[model samples]
Target: MELGTSLEKRKVPNMLKRILQYDVQLTKKFVDLALRTTTLKSLRNHAKLFEVSCHGIVWLACWLSFIWLFNNKELYQLQVNMFIALILDIVVIAVIKAFVRRRRPVPMNKLMELGPDKFSFPSGHTSRAVLVAFILICLNPISIIFYPPLLAWVTAVSISRVLQERHYLLDVVCGAGVGLLEGLFMALIWFSQSASASILSSLSDEKLDGGEYHV
Candidate 1:
């Protein structure tokens, strides 16, 4: 009847317990808000389609098109830079999700489909949307008229992740941060070097009169 000294149980440290309790409370607040916010119902209804658009097949098609355009067009650096940045974003998100091992917010039954992805600390779809949007804004390849709409779309995509209950608020926040940093990092290196040089050369040539340096 000794019971082997009750297995010498050790309690979790108070600090860790407090942190966990805080996280649970915060998650609950977010979940409650999402449930009550009726404005997001449209996105919630279409959220599965939005989520699947970020799947690997869509990304592959995009990259393949970029590769073709890069080879045939004059925008080699821009296309290559975007392609590489997207690839990097995918790698970074995948690694972070694996390392963190955070579970998705929605139950398996609520999910649209159960596939390769399960863990969801940082929302990969949100990250990719932010990264792509950031790249286009920085590069300025498209007309200014299109930027606002593109930004709105990106915002909607990020919100849809939460509305669909696939991710918590913090997951999208961290994912956005990671994506923005990646975009800035790529822009600083790629745009500052080759892109800048090409742009400057074009500007200088436009000012040239007879091949001598213009004052």
Candidate 2:
């Protein structure tokens, strides 16, 4: 339940009752395995849905957008901030990939192996997508409702990475973790800067008052 916890080993109490929506003990017990299998299989099948949640692509698009509007030179401040967030997310992802140094899930393996590459664990797509989704929601609360499709898109992307034989599930999940850390780091920086500015402003106001008294 903690923030950034791996989706694995994420147990659900009363799985049959909750998933199947039948609280009857006998029926629940009877259908537990079926329900569990059905739910997991369905989710894995749809893992492709979360593919778009990749940080690299999302940040690259954001970078392109920034460049596209660069000539205007009057872009909204929010765009600037998003640009910074994108950059930060990317750097964090790269650093994490290097540190983790995991292997791809068996390339071309019938069950796994989609895209084979050097980096694995913590899906970069997942992390970036989640970060973008968070920022978008912060800028406009309404965007939160759209998180489902976005999350699905990101998950699909993660699945695609597997299908393409690039990354394993763990790699994708780890990418998501790095992204979360990046977002949190950005938020803390913004808040700290804002607080410092406020304190400086107060000090300035006090100095002005002392000057006026002397005058």
Candidate 3:
């Protein structure tokens, strides 16, 4: 209800809004061109391939192993950043899940035919896709190579939610917002921690020098 109301209140041009609605609906019905949500199907497939798959544990572990082999400082920074981001992702996802309890499309409108009728208002699958993609892109500028496939997968994930009667357009949009913020805030947290460590190390060096540098 809140998601729908917020979307209704947006200041979109009438024609564009109508066009968008039609596009979304048309995309939803095209089973031949897309995959709909199914725990045993689309979502699971992404979990196998997408970064941050399997609740992000797989992504983190894989990144760590790769980083250890490559030993790049910049990659290390991003790993730290995404580590923070994943934590924020968990916090935001948990809070939203509890606060905005909306039924899935199937329950809200019985006539809607789809699969995976569960949880609305911030699709978890969308959240995972967005956060993982955000982190991967930021970690390496060349990660742009993954852009097309990553974006396609994210689009597919969002479409699956709608087609599967699991979420509304608004839910997916807001979930993307939350996921993006998760990466941003996580980067901030990493910078702060990195700064603190630097400061602490500097103080230790000073102490070891007997309080001052001996020229």
Highest-scoring model, lDDT: 1
Tens-digit lDDT track for model 2 on 24-143? Answer: 233233233323576544544555544433536655786666544343322333444566677787677677767655555443336653453467655667677767666666542344
lDDT ranking from best to worst?
A: 1, 3, 2
Superposed Cα RMSD, model 3: 9.3
Q: Give the local distance difference test score of model 3.
A: 0.59
lDDT of 3 by residue, 57-140 (tens): 565577556534543334445545555566667667767877765555542346554444345667766787788787667743
> How high is the lDDT of residue 205 in model 2?
47
Cα lDDT listed for each candidate = 0.71, 0.54, 0.59
- Among these predictions, the greatest TM-score belongs to 1
- Native-to-model Cα distance after best TM-score fit, residue 196 in candidate 2, in Å: 17
29-126: candidate 1 lDDT, tens digit per residue: 76566666786666677887887766555876877665543333245456567767778888998899887776776543363554567888788888
Q: Candidate 3, which segments miss by more than 4 Å at Cα?
A: 1-74, 107-118, 138-140, 190-215
Residue 160 of model 3, lDDT score? 57
Worst 10 residues of 3 by lDDT: 47-56
The candidate with the higher lDDT, 1 or 2, is 1
- The local lDDT score (0 to 100) that residue 4 gets in candidate 3 is 93
Q: Give the TM-score of each candidate.
A: 0.72, 0.52, 0.54
